[model samples]
Every structure is written in structure tokens, then in C-alpha cells.
Target: MKILVTGANGFIGSNFCKFLVSQQIFPRVFIRKNCDMSLFKQLVPEWKQLEYVYGDLRDKSSIRPAVRGVEYIFHIAGTIKGSSWIEFYEGNCLGTLNLIKICEEENPDIKRLVFTSSMVAGGPGTPESPQCEDTPSKPLENDWYGISKYYTECCSKKQTNKLPIVIIRPPMVIGPGDKISFDLFNIAKIGIKVFVSGTPRQFSMVHVEDLVKGIFLCGTHPKAIGETFNFAYDGTISYRDLHEVIATKLFHRKYGNLIPIPIPPPLFYFVGLILELVSKISHEPPFLNRPKAIQASASGQTMSNQKAKQILGWKPKFSKISALEHAGRWYQQQKWL
Candidate 1:
């Protein structure tokens, strides 16, 4: 089937494209003007199969040709590490709206739109309560990423009454080509023992390969229409346990020496606010006081993939250990470490 994948040069999108090619399905890629295409070059040799169109999702005119004759649309483009909420809104929310408009006007035949969303949309501040698809998006204050994704889903649902829309909420996807997990790997390499709140919060995670498989299934599976699926691992692991897995795989170290410090949640917020204020003026990502840390340590962010497994016949093959091993090997190949 001919498909159109937006943000095809990014970590998850590029990996998804590679996975499609392995299955002998080379979808057309819609890349932004400034996105680096080096990753695409390294992965696919026969570039002819991977048709790329230079377009910005925020501009409806540029996106029209890309959707022509496309059977499915994997709308995955968005800005994550932004310095301001405006960037997140324009890049993610408005961009998604423009894509929906293009699909409505240019390609009415496109029957499926598989949107990739984050688990943060459900707000990852409480670990005790596991979030499901029906939960309202109680996004934390200043959580632009979560808010933007939530609005994207809302806009897509409003536009597509006849077409099928499947939203996949993936939690902390880690694999061979991810930059977010690379930070953890780098920290582990330095023998810097990672520390977290003593409160054992669960981290719902999935391998990139497994997430891509879930997306492909959602694009074609009849039961997936008008549904939101949490494509996380079947089981949830503690933050400390996750760190230990990373250390063991990358550094070959035992789980000891990892520090677990218990700090009040309010204190973390105060410090984060201070850092954010400074970052706002400096135009930089806060190094020490990012809000993501509080969510990571205090929030459970645990989700059950039972629905996906039972409905879509999706099973995640890579365990946390396997994911780390593969990530380490990929880092070595790229000389990232």
C-alpha cells in the first residue's frame, strides 16, 4: 500500500520508515525544510523507493501533493524539545490541523490516519493510578508537549467523520536510534550513578520496533479505527530497575551503587520553576530543573498493553535488557559514545 509518513527523518519516523522498507513497503516521506536527511541516506540505499517531498506541515499548500494517491497517512511530525509553548503549538497543533485540511481537500480516498501521541497526554504525575484511553487529558501546567498532542488528536477527530483515525500513545520509546535514551546511556558510561526519588514509580516503555509494528497494525487493522491504543510493554518496571538494566547492558555493572533519594514533590517543582525562568531568557533547555524529571520519578506513567495485544495481535519482542543491548551496539557503530 502507498503511504505517506511525515517527519520521516526523525528518530521514530525514520525507524518506522526503515521497518516499512524491510517489509517491502517503501512509503513516501514528507520532510521539513531544515530536517537533516543524513539518517535516511544511511538506512536506505535505493533512494528511489523512498520518495521524499519537501514540505512543511504548517503550510497546507506544500502538503497537498504529498498526500495525492496516498492510501494511508502516518502523521508523526512535531517539535518536542522547544524553548517556548508557541513553538510547540505552531509546530505540532497547527501543523496537524493543516495536514487534516490537506487530506480533506486533496485526498479524500485516504481512509486511514495513524497519529502517534505521547503517554504524557494523560499526565504522568501519579504512579499509583494507571491511565487508560478513556482518561481525560489532565495535562500538567506548562506541559506544552502533552497539551499540543492532545489538541492534535482533538483536531483530527473533528475533521475526519468518514475516515478512520487511530491514535497510538507510546510511553518512553527506546531503541537503536533514539536520542532521548542516548542521554541515559551517556550518563551510565561516565560511571555516574543515576539517582531518583525513593518512591518507586513505574515507567511504561516500548521498543521502537514494537511501536512501529503497532502503528502499521493500526493503519490496516479494521478494529483499530476510532480507538486509542497504549503501545507500551506488557509489564511496567520501576525507574531504578530501568536504570539498572541500562547499566548492566552498557557498563556491565551490577545494580548496586545506584542512589535513590527521596525529595518532596513540591521542592522539585520550585526548583524547576526557577530553572525554567532562567531558561526562558537564555533560550536553552533547562539542564537541571526540567519538569520531565518530576514526571519521570513521581508519576507512574504505567499503561497496560493488553488491549493492543488482544485486539491487534501485537506483542513486544524486545525486553528492557534487549533494548539497551541494541542501543549500545548502535551507539558504538555511530561512534556516539
Candidate 2:
């Protein structure tokens, strides 16, 4: 089967490529010219089978050739952070719209186009109630990243009749090769654990391996077409619990001595505002901006994976503790910790 995976060099995309190659399926990978190939290079023999197509999601002309003769399209590329709303829209919204247009106009042989959206698009659910597939999205206007994804989903729906579209909205994805979680682990290693203030915020997360499995299932399963699913573990975890898990795995029982500090909601917003101001001059988006801080401080951004389980016959293979340990071990092995 000839498949095309955009953002093939990214964390989730690279993992998905590894999974496909392991199944004896060498996918045609679409990536930007400057994307790091070190991860794919490490695959050695298997990497040779991958067909590389250099392209940018924002460029329709570049995307055209990448979609040609492909049976499956995994649209996994999008900007997570940007200096402005325009950057987010261009990368996430326009990029997605361009791909859908190409597939609709040119790729008659395309069997499935799996779009990797995010839980941010669906709006965060509370601890008592997790968001499901049917939950209506309520993204804030200022939340450019989330709004961009929401727009991408909208674009996907426009081509549902012409293309078999499957949208996978995954919550906080954690596992090997994940840098965000690695940052958390590093913070814990320093003996200071930070928590957001207000009502305790909880999150739903899935290991990258399990998430890619769900993506594959969405691509292959008949019932998944024209459907949207949230991929996450069965339960949710508080921020404090997440830190404790990482600290325990990194330092074992000695994590009990780590100091826990809570940042008030207003302070988070203030810091975000300051970062946003600095970004205007630097022209580079800071890791933590005002909108992100607001999101971090918000309570209960969890989701249910019941739809994925029932529709695609999928469930996470790793528990939270086991998954964190797996990620920590990978980081240590790579000397990233």
C-alpha cells in the first residue's frame, strides 16, 4: 500500500512511520526541506524503503506531488506555537485546506485521509465529565492554535463526500521521543514541581505508540470513515499526579523530598502576557505565551476514548505509570535527560 504521511519527521509522525515500517509497509513521507532526518536515519535498513518528498504544508504546489498516487494520507503536520495568529492559520488551517483540495481534485485513488487534530479543538472537559466525540467545540477566539485545528476539522468535513476523512483528536500525547513531557521530567529532576492554581486541572493523555495505533485503526477501519474520535487513556490525571509520576520514575523513592509550588492563575496569565510582549519584539514565539498560560491554568481538559474503543476496537496498551516509565527510559537512553 502506498501511503503519504505529512510531517513525517516530527515526533508523532516519525513514530507512525516506524510503526508502518515494522508492519512491512514503507510509506511515502512528506516533509519540509530542513526537517531533521536523524530519527528516520536511525532506522537504517527500514529507512531505505521510505520515499521522501520534500514539501511545505502551506504551499499547495508543494503538496500536489506529495498526494499523487497515494492510497492513504496522514495529515499530521501543524504549528503548535507561533508568533502570531496568521502563522497558526497559515500552517494549520490553510495548510489543511490545501491538502483537502488536492485530494479532492486529484487523488481519486486515495482511500483514506486521517487528520490528526487535537483535544484543544474540542474544548477541555472537567474531571467529572470528559469530552466525547459528540461534544460541540467551543474554542476561544484568542486561542489561535485550537481555533486553527477547529478550522482544519471544518475543512475536512467539506470534503467528506469526496474523500473518506477520519479525524483523530488526541489529548496530551506522551511517550518516547516527546520533548514536552521531557521538559516536565527535567523540571522535576531539579527538585521543584510546579502546579497551576485554581480548581486542580486534570488532563487525559495517551502514549505515542498507542496513539499511532489508533491512527492506523482509523485509516483501515470502515466504520471510522466520516467519523471523529478522541484518543486517550481510560482515566485522567491531575497535574500534581503527573509530576509525581515523572519524579518517581526519574529518581525512584527519593522524589518524596521534592518541593511542590503552585502558581496562582493570575500569575500564569501575567507571565504569559509578559512573554507575549517579548515575542512581539523578538518575532519568535516563546514556549509559554499568554494564551497557553490561560490554557495551562484552566481546569479539567480531559476527554473520553470510548468512541475510539467502540468504533475502531482500540484501547491504550499502557497505563499512565507504565507509559511515563517508558518515556523516561527512552529519554535516558538517548541522553536527553
Candidate 3:
């Protein structure tokens, strides 16, 4: 079956394309004008079977050609930068709208559209709580990234009717080639000690490969259509255990001096402002952006993925340490650390 994958060069998209190719299926990729395809080249060497199209999700005319005659469209492309939320709306909300329009006009015969949504929309500190597929997302979610994803879901539900559409809400997706998790790895490698909030907060995570498997099944699984599936591990990890895992791997020994001091959110913002000013002058990003870190840490985040396993028969294979080890090795190979 022919399929179209947007952002095929991104971390998750590239991984999913590679998975499909390994299964002997060729999937066409739609990319934007300025996106670098070098990531695709290094990761997926069997490019002859992979079709490439240049289009912008913000432009209706540009998206039409890519949607033609495809059986499935995995809409995995979206913005995730914590700073500057306007870009998120344009890329995530408006971009999805354009693709949905194209699907209606060009590929009305498409089998399904599988959208990758974020778990942040469910709110922070959600572990130890039973979150079902039909739970209404708390409207008080503060993060801009989550807000953009929530709106994307709204737009998709409104405009989509030609084909069955399934939403995959994944938690802290972990695997190789992830820059966000690389931050934690880097700190461990350098033997730097830091403080973590001393609370028994659970964090949900999924291997990239497992997430890919879920996405592939979502396209064809009849039971998955029009359903929202949480694609996370069945279990959760605490902040203390998470830090210990990284420290042990990086330091070759157990180490902990974590100060659990809950600084006021406003004080955190004050520090962020100074860091932002310095970053602007130095032409470099701050270690932690004020708004993003405050939101992520302050609001505990976790979820359950029972629906994905039950509906799609998807099982994740990587543990937290295994994921960290794979990411560390990749960083060493790429000299990214």
C-alpha cells in the first residue's frame, strides 16, 4: 500500500520511514522547502524507493500534489519549540488544516490519517491516575506546546470526514537521535550534580520503535479509526529513579545529592529573563528557557497507554536505561555531545 509521511526527515518520522522500508513497503515523503534532508540520507540509505515532494503545509496549493493517490497519510509533522509559540500555531494548527484540506480535495479515497499528538495536552502530574481514551483534556494546561497540539486536534476533528482519522497521544517518546533527552545525558556525562523536585511524580515514556509500530498499526487498524489512543508504557518512573538511572550509566557509580527545593514560579521566571537577555546578546540559547522549564517541572507529567496495547497489540521494548545507552552511543558517534 502506498502512503505519505510528512516530516519524514524528523526524528520520529525518519524512524517510522526506516521501519516501513525494513518491512519492504515504500512510503512517499513530503518535506518543506528549507528542511535539511541530510538526516534522511544518513538514516535511510534505501532512498530509491522513497518518493520525495517539496511542499509547505501553510500553503493550500503546495500540499495538493503530495496528497494525490496515497492510501494512508501519517501526519507526524509539527512544531515543538518551547519558546516563541506563534510558530507553533502556524506550523502545527495551520499546517494540519492545510493537509486536511488537501486530503479532502486530492485524496478522498485515502484509507486513514494518523495524527501524532502530545501527552502534554492531558496536563501535568497525571500518573497514578486512570486516564481513559475519552477523558476530556483539562483546559487549564499552561504549556504553549500542549496548547498548540490541543488546537490541532480540534482542527482535525472539525475538517476531516473523507477518511478515518486516529489520534496517537504519546508520552516522552524515548529512543536514539532525540535532542531533548540528550540534555539529560550530557549532564550525566560531565559528572554534574543537580537538584530535582523531591516528589514521587511519575513520568510516562515510550520507545521510538514502539511508537513507530503504533503509528503503522493506527493507519490500518479498523478499531483505531476515530479513536484516541495513549501510546505510552504501561508503567511510570519517578524523578529520583530517573536521575539515578542516568547517573549510574554516566558516572559508572551511584551518586545523589539532589536538593529538593521548590522555588517559587515567579523567581524562576526572574532568572529566565536574565538568561534570555544574555542569550540574545551572546547569540546562544540558554541552558533552560524560563517559561518552558518552569512549566514542565512545576506541572508533573505522566500518562497510561493501556488503549494502544489493547487496540493495536503494540508493546514497547526499551527500558529507561536501554534508551539512554542507545542515545549516548549515538551522541558519541555523531559527536553531538
Candidate 4:
């Protein structure tokens, strides 16, 4: 099968490419001209079998050649961290629309266009009540990332009649080569557990490997056409519990010695405000900002994966503890801890 994997140099995308190679499937990879190829180089050593297409999601003209004549297109390219909402919209919303347009015009033979959306796009559910595909999106006005992803989902649905498309919404993905989870591991390595507030926030997560498998299933499963599936583990974990797991895996000790520090919600908001101001002056995005602060302060953010399992025969292979241990081992090997 001819396949095109966009954003193949990113964390999940790179891992997906690696999975394809392991399965003896050589796929054409579409990547930005300025993307960092470090992860790709480390994961995929058999570059001779793979085809590379250089393009940007922002440029409509560049996407045509990449999408043309491909049986499947895994559209995973999007801006995850940005200095402003415009950047996220340009890359996630407008970029998705441009890709759909090119697929319609240039790739009529495409069997499936698997889109990678986020669970945040569907917004959050209460800790007691996990969200499902049927849940309505209540994205916060300040959560630009979620807004952009939600818009992308809407664009994909609008194009479903014109083209074959399947959307997979993955929750917080954890595994090797993941910088987002690595931050938490780094913090835990220092024996400090930082909480945004006294209130506990719940989150659902999936391992990168399992998420890639789910994406592959979405592309291949006949029943997945014109449908959206949430790809997450079976259950949710509190933020404090997640931190404790990371600390346990890293320190190999109980959580008693770990310092639990709580930052008031107001102080967290102030920090975000200060970072936003500095970002404006320096023209560089701060590691923490208003949108991130708002998300961190929110209490509930969980999702259900029953749809994916029932419809696509997909289930996560790693439990939370196993996933954390695997990530911790990788960090230790890389000396990231």
C-alpha cells in the first residue's frame, strides 16, 4: 500500500514511521523543510527504502505533490506549542482545510485520510464521567490549542462527504522521545511534585506506540470511514497520582520523601501573565503561558476509548505503570533525568 505520513519527523509521527518500517512497509514521509530530523534519524535507519517529500502545511501548493497518488495520508502535522492563537490557527485550522482541499483536487484515489486530532478538542469531562465521542465540545475560549484542534475536526467532518477521512483524538501521549512527558519526569527526578492547586485534575493518556497502532487501525479499518474515535487508555488518573507514578519509577522509592509543593491558582495565573508579557517583548514563546495555565488549573480532563475498541478492535498494550516505567528507562538511557 502506498502511504504518506505527514509530520513524520515529530514525536508520534516519527514513532509511526518506525512502526511502518518494522512492519516491512516503506512509506512516503512528508515533512517541513525546517523540521528537526534528529528523531527520524535515530528511529529509522533504513532511509533508502523510504521516500521523502519536502513541504509545509501552510503552503497549499506544496501539499498537492505530497498527497497525489497516495492510498492513505496520515495528516499529523500541526502546531502544538505557539506564542499566539494565530500560529495555532494557521497551522492546525487553515492547514487542515488546505490539506483537505488538495486531497479533493489532487488525490481522488485516496482510500483513507487519517487525521490526528487531540482529546482536548472534545474538551474535558468530569472525573466521575469520562467523555465519549458523543460528548459535545466545550473548549475554553482561552485554550487556543484545543480551539485549533476542534476547528480541524470540524473541517475534516465537512470534507468527509467529498473524501474518505477518519479522525482519531488522542489524549496526553506518553512514551519515549516525548518531550511533554519528559518535563514531568525531569521534575520528578528532582524529588519535587508541583501541583497547580489543591484541586486534583484528572487526565487520560495513551502510550505513543499504542496511539500509532490506533492510527494505523483507523486508516485500515473499513468501518472507520467518516468517523471519529477517541484513542485513550481505559481509565483516568489524577495529576497527583501521575506525578507519584513518575516519582516512583524514577527514584525507585516510595512517595513519602518527595516534596509536594502547591502553587496557588492565582500565582499560577500571575506566572502565566508574566510569561505572556515576556513573550510579547522577546518575541519568543515562554514555556508556560495563559492557555497552559488555564488548562493546568482545570480539574477534569478524561476521555473514553470504547468506540475505538468496539469499532476498530484497538486496545492499549501498556498500563499506566508499564508506560511510565518504559519512559523512565528511556530517560535514564538518554541521561535526560
Predicted structure with the largest TM-score when compared to the true one: 4
Query: By TM-score, how accurate is candidate 4?
Result: 0.94
The better candidate by lDDT, 2 or 4, is 4
Task: Please report how far candidate 1 places residue 208 from its true position, in Å.
Answer: 0.3
User: lDDT: which candidate is best?
Assistant: 4
Q: For candidate 3, write residues 28-53 as lDDT tens digits.
A: 89998877667677768897678888
Give the candidate order by descending TM-score: 4, 2, 1, 3
By TM-score, is 1 or 3 better? 1
Better of 1 and 2 by lDDT: 2
What lDDT score belongs to each candidate, Candidate 1 first? 0.77, 0.83, 0.74, 0.84
For candidate 4, the per-residue lDDT at 25 reads 90
Candidate 2's C-alpha runs over 4 A off are 43-45, 254-256, 270-287
Q: Lowest summed lDDT over 10 consecutive residues: which window, candidate 3?
A: 256-265
lDDT of 1 by residue, 61-175 (tens): 8999999999999988887766567888998898888887778788877779998888877776344567777777776666677788888877777765766788889888877
Q: What does candidate 2's lDDT look like per residue over 139-209, in tens digits?
A: 65577888889888887888888889999998888776675567678877777777786567888888999
Residue 33 lDDT (model 4): 83
Which pairs clash inside model 2? none
lDDT of 2: 0.83
**Lowest-scoring 10 consecutive residues by lDDT in candidate 1?**
284-293
Cα-based TM-score, every candidate = 0.89, 0.93, 0.88, 0.94
* lDDT against true structure, model 3: 0.74
Question: Which portions of model 4 show Cα errors greater than 4 Å?
Answer: 272-288
